[model samples]
Target: MLKIRNLVGGYTNTPIINGVDFEISKGEFFVLLGPNGSGKSTIFKLITGQLPCQKGEISINDKSLSSFSKLEKAKKVAVLSQEVQISFDYTVEEIISLGRFPHQKGLFKTLSVEDKEVIEEVMEITKVKQYRDTQFRMISGGEKQRVLLAKVLAQQPEVLLLDEPTNHLDIKHTFQMLDLLKEWQQTKGLTIFAILHDLNVAALYADRIALLHKGSFLDVGDVDTLRKESQLETVYEVKVNAQSHPTVPKPQLLMTPNHSKTKSELLNFDTSFSITKNDQFIHVQFESPLRTISNGVIGEGIQWLKHFCNFHVEKHYNGSNPKQDLQKWMEKYEIPFEQSVAMMTAVRLEDVVIVTKQIEDIKVIAVVTAGTGNAVDITNSSLSQSHEKVGTINSMVFIDAHFTDGALVNGFMSATEAKVKALHDLNVKDPETNTMATSTSTDALLLAVTQQGKETQYAGSGTVVGKVIGQTVYEATHKAVQKYFHRLQK
Candidate 1:
């Protein structure tokens, strides 16, 4: 546990830290975030007693930090600074063994069996055992960081201070270091205080974040509270967009780029598409890979792809695993599987419906192809159907507008709701459930956009973008569904 209240300090005649107040709960992974020269490293110095506090108090476990002796402080707190320089050619094992000096009688004292065991364990934990005899200067930058970390672990301190520990490391090493720290914090209840530049990294690991600006604490709270786009934009003096991580549900910040775009340049839509029809399939091509979100077989869910195909499969075609079949087809056709999105249906391409609408000067387009073979009313499905429909419905929405990824996700949700509402309006139902059918069992939806013009931040139900998606998808889907039912009657 660490506590700092009304903390003020800096070099004489030039104060760096303003009145700062915060507390780190026991065993909490707390992070400090700010731009360069925000006095983050200065705070570390004040806490470790390298720089004396001009005012206020810092305490560890209710004990004043100033009360601790050099050895006492070393035993309770360990710091890894932003840079570590090794001018001397010291062996990795020898460097790490120095951490045991605080516990021993003196630096020159004979090493004990317990010290050796701790050194071995720390080396193994940090994955530096193989480099034990190598000179610290001979290893890679990431290896040096790991070796230094092993030394700090050898100190057996309860509290660890990391100042941009991931700086200069590659992605792999950065993640490896943080993942190890997280594991240690959870398993050993090690308290950690770190300063990080990457907002996403802090969100992923920190229990709470403290934002510092110009030697003062701007805000301090949980990740979600401190990472508001407006707050971060003001603090960092840049445009910021907050979005959820696709897999983790954590808030991540993306810095908006600043540039000038003329009206003519902004209006130039770089997106173009071509649709080709064969006897058994329809191929859709894009001028470039579009940021697409879909449930199609190949390019399913939030990816960049340039091509898609809607194939006509037989009613009795093996449907046990559509993705597997798609994979086989892609390999046979020599397609770049990762760059393609594909779907299948018993209905022909001629039956697809395309609808276009304009909302608030933005253009929205919807393409829908429907089938009822696999439709089900999700409410009362206990009754077994005498026959199962093997058809599929595939829909695509394209917008001549720009959107943030978060807004795009919201647009997808709104579009789906509109499609189901269209079905309800048509009185479409599943005989088993006696309720309106929302979506078919194997339905696929694709959301794409030209990403031109002004940026739309939110696409919830009340937004203009949402309204356009609702109206266009509803009209298009209604027509497609009606066509499907008419074909069924025939």
Candidate 2:
């Protein structure tokens, strides 16, 4: 319902918005994103007529913005600017009542029933009703933001312009404000055009995003279009990692500081292994935090951790939740949970196999500990419901090679595939299914890399790094399994 074409304007002779053209559809939540001084606020001022338009046309519903009178524009458009300061200490109710001025009849206008109802409804919606009678200055900045938002909603305009609406709000209030706006946009069909700095917020709430850079639109499309890591890196001139939201499909950008250092840089490589022994556990410490990818019960998924440990307990020691037990053990030992990644395994430390191979000026290390006491084949036709033992085949592959984020994920998958290939090669069978066992009932694999030497872009089976991983893991797992089978034969 709001459209700007070739919009060019600025404070002085220099144009801040140069030849920008875009349209905001009716009932659409559109966001304008940019770094500081990228002309986001300038565009808002041009649209609201606060600053004189140097060139181009801005229209609302086929009507020129210049054609509308002040009161008429107020009725159609509501604006919430960044700087919200009051000269006098006004009550929250009094501030919200001012929004009804555009709809009032005369100078000494009395509050109509409809106006009072709208004010109350808005206060309730914005969750500012608790402090409705409190002085606006007395409440916190976040509360004040919600109060002002209530005032804007009180205006009941067709289109709302928000400039950093969630600036002063905490996480709770931030979500509340955005949720209210989203609900209004959907139910009341209120078209919203907002300027936001938080990429995650924009990704979650905005139907479409327009990325502004240096007085022009750099990219304008749906969230996916503007969520590219490279696109964001170029526009913001900072390192950005785009990841999916935990429970949603929206993309979130994580900023990496320029001075940030990885584990490989901080840890000295004096010894290949750093092992710590205790009566109940064995801690395997690393020189530095390694980029790890695993599906283990503890510290699953991709992360960076310095230590990996195996918790040992007596044969009679039974814990219902292994993870909770391991966490308690970690707390008892004063281990930094954030810095360590641990797993539970029944196999003894002496039975673990460690192998290393040097290729292309880099070293790849593989470690494996296997047990076939309770192996189960997933492809078996007859399903077994036995929960007697949690047989584990823990495998780890480490390389002194650098990798991109994509390669880390690919490395884990390739290593897992290689492990399964090793199982098939060793002729391990699931007794119940009489089929080649693909994996143990409880198998966990970790892929750690020092991130040194040449950068490996992708670690699929075809890549050099992938080849080393496959060969090492295949050989190492074969030996580890054979050792376990030899114990069984004894």
Candidate 3:
């Protein structure tokens, strides 16, 4: 357990962590979060005694940090700061064994059986046992990070301090390492205090979160309370969209319109009937309405509903009968004309990490699907088929009247996140432990939208059920478009 009262510290005479107060219960995984220069790292420094404490007090297990001798603190608290520049090319086992030094008496201490067991256990948990004999410098940066973590674990301290532990890791390694840390915490009741840059990662593992900004504590509480978009925007001083993970209480972030990137970027939806912009850049506007439907063109579940605008309209099937021609194009382009699966995730225009060369002015739609299936049908699916490659998934759609293209290919993302996140938003522990549950459909539903046209473009695809979802939407949008276009004719 740890507590801080009116803590204040910083470099030189300037104060960074001013009047900060928070506490961590025993066995809690607490995280400090904030933008760069917000003093999260500085707070760690003050607590670790790396920098002299300017004001306030810090205590562990009701004992003042000031009162604990350096060696005593080493036994009680283990710190893994961001920087661990090694001067010697020590073997992985040698480095890990160093964590046991506090437990050893004066110099020339011999290894005890207990110490060797702890070292081996630490190596196994961190997955660096194989590298026990290898030099630390030979491994990749990410691997070395794991080694350092193992070393800290070998310390077997009561409290743990980690500074951006996952900064060097990729997505896969990040999860693996966190999994190790979590397992240790659960089994050993090791309390963690960390400063994390990635809010999503923090949300995934941290039991509680503290938000900081401009060298001040913006707020400190469980992730659910601080994950709201409004609070995030206020702290970041920018437009943002925050969503809680579906099954976890932690909040994820999506920065809005990359106003800094460029003003020329645009996204439109073509639903055959008409073309409408998904977002208009270069100014302030009201937030999007609570919901919008896509032609299942590009949408994630609980996905960004703003893109769903005006409803489905009837597509006059014209009976033009391009059956053979449509089939030919579908085959030629590797498009999935029938039931295809895809993933979609929506962030505000800004959060998107754009990669382009020509900057083709086009509309983008995201279609998504989320389902739990044990049925193994993997080998039979076509590997070449892709909606986006066929100029469909996450693309600009054209809307229409009396005729919907029903051709725009895409996947769903946001909606799936939102639906999954419902449990996460509750921020309740043991959500699944409640025995009784009710839900009939095992099928994953898709959401779509046509951006530019009125007729065929607005008409959707997939099963009869998929098309039925657009009924209400198409009906409303049909009227709205007819009235607008008809007015333009005048």
Give Cα-based local distance difference scores for all models.
0.83, 0.83, 0.56
TM-score attained by model 1: 0.86
Put down candidate 2 lDDT per residue, 330-402, tens digits, no spaces: 9998876667667766665567787888767667888777776657677786667343553568887777788
Candidate 1 all-Cα RMSD: 3.5
TM-score of 3: 0.61
Off by over 4 Å in 2: 260-266, 270-273, 277-279, 312-320
Worst 10 residues of 2 by lDDT: 261-270
Q: Looking at candidate 1, what is the lDDT of residue 367?
A: 79
Badly placed stretches (over 4 Å) of model 3 are 105-107, 247-250, 260-333, 336-490
Q: Provide the lDDT at 225 for model 3.
A: 48
> Can you give the lDDT of residue 446 in candidate 2?
80
- Ordered by TM-score, highest first, the candidates read 2, 1, 3
Q: After TM-score superposition, what is the CA distance of residue 480 in candidate 2 from its true location, in Å?
A: 2.7
* Total backbone clashes of candidate 2, pairs 3 or more residues apart or in separate chains: 0
For 403-430, candidate 3 gives per-residue lDDT tens digits of 2223332122322323333223322122
